[model samples]
Target: MSVPILKQGDVLIASIQSALTDRDLLQLKDELAEKVGRLRSRGVVIDVTALDVMDSFATRTIRSIAAATRLRGAETVVVGIQPEVAIALVELGLTLDGIATALDLEEGLDVLVEVMEARRRDR
Candidate 1:
């Protein structure tokens, strides 16, 4: 199923609630990029609180989404990673690297807002 992507002011929020296939990730990337451009979004928050598995494909797909959004001038923040998922990701040698992360959706939104504001001030 396609994930729900919502718009909150200038930020786009995508919450993943089930296991995702390769197709889902690709669709998400496309939809997010389209939304960011159409809405002129300044930030994005991807909430994975309900996701139980964090495989290599999922990791790479998320990072790809972040990078694509960044290229469109929107910062991305991932939120709601469970403890086990975190450990699994680490054991699998997967690090999020340049992507920003938060403990929960609320925090993720806050982080995105802060980063966007900082960027605005820098210009």
Candidate 2:
């Protein structure tokens, strides 16, 4: 139950294998903060497709993770949401609306790289 971090064309990609709950949220928060800090660029991708269920704790933890990343001046893109989870979230009217999501890792990376490239151009 840990998050694995990798680098791809200046983007930081992270995959979490643990169920998100209060008991594990603290560890996740700590590790994610550290990993985001270590990233070489401001673009990051968080893949949670393996997550079986998303409760309030899970939702809030992901929000926290996104916030933490943003605070470090990094942008987070979530990818690979299970179809059932998507339907559940919609049915429940859950608001993960503020966070950016992509269809898959490839799409997520494309979005990240596009945004990063835009930022580079602006700089």
Candidate 3:
């Protein structure tokens, strides 16, 4: 199933409501990248609260999504990673290296706001 991406102010919120296949993950990455540019969004928040499993492919795809959107001039924040998933990713040696993360959607948006504000100040 296709992920629903919503435009909230200058941010695009892509909430993953279920466990997605590799194809769905790739589609989401592409869709978010395209929308970030088309919508001229300053930030992207990906909520993965409902995702119980985040395998290597999913982790890599999410990292690529962040990198792609960043190149398009939008900051990306991933939120709602469960404790078990976090431990699993760490044990598997998969890291979300350069991507920003938050505990929930509210914190995710807050992080985006802070990052956007910092960028503005830098400019």
Candidate 4:
């Protein structure tokens, strides 16, 4: 499985296709962390439509990416979560309070643009 990275206007959109198991999670995590620093803009949209599950480690990696992106003066947004996975996350008592999520790519891009615009003004 390959992770695709695309630049969408002012946003760097990363799509994690196929299954995101613990084995490959960290590789994606590392790449994401690296992108936070290299991104031309401080806005990211991580498309998780293909992800069927979010284990503890994967959740941890997402948290780490969020933290790292924020540290780099950027924001991370998760998009298109599988219904069951969303339910599981809630049952697990996971809090995505600060993390923004979108229902699809279009919405994710909209949110990313808004966040990036706000960041631009602040900086």
lDDT of 4 by residue, 58-112 (tens): 7787788777877877788999998999999999987577888999989988888
Give the runs in model 4 whose Cα sits over 4 Å from its true position.
Answer: 121-123
Candidate 3, residues 12-121: lDDT per residue as tens digits? Answer: 99999998989999999989989998999999999999999999999999999988998999999999999999999999999799889999999999999998898789
Ordering by TM-score: 3, 1, 4, 2
lDDT of 1 by residue, 1-123 (tens): 899999999999999989899999899999999999999999999999999998999899999999999999999999999999999998988989989999998999889988888878998
Residue 23 CA error for candidate 4 (Å)? 3.7
Per-candidate RMSD vs. true structure?
Answer: 0.9, 2.3, 0.9, 1.8
C-alpha lDDT of candidate 3 relative to the true structure: 0.94
**Clashing pairs for predicted structure model 4, backbone only:** none
Give lDDT: candidate 3, residue 91.
98
How many clashes in each candidate?
Answer: 0, 0, 0, 0
Q: What is the lDDT of candidate 1?
A: 0.94
CA lDDT, candidate 3, residue 8: 97
Candidate 3 global TM-score:
0.96
Give the TM-score of each candidate. 0.96, 0.81, 0.96, 0.86
For residue 41, model 2's alpha carbon misses the true position, in angstroms, by 3.0
Clashing pairs in 2: none
RMSD of 4: 1.8
Give the CA lDDT, 0 to 100, for residue 112 in model 1.
Answer: 90
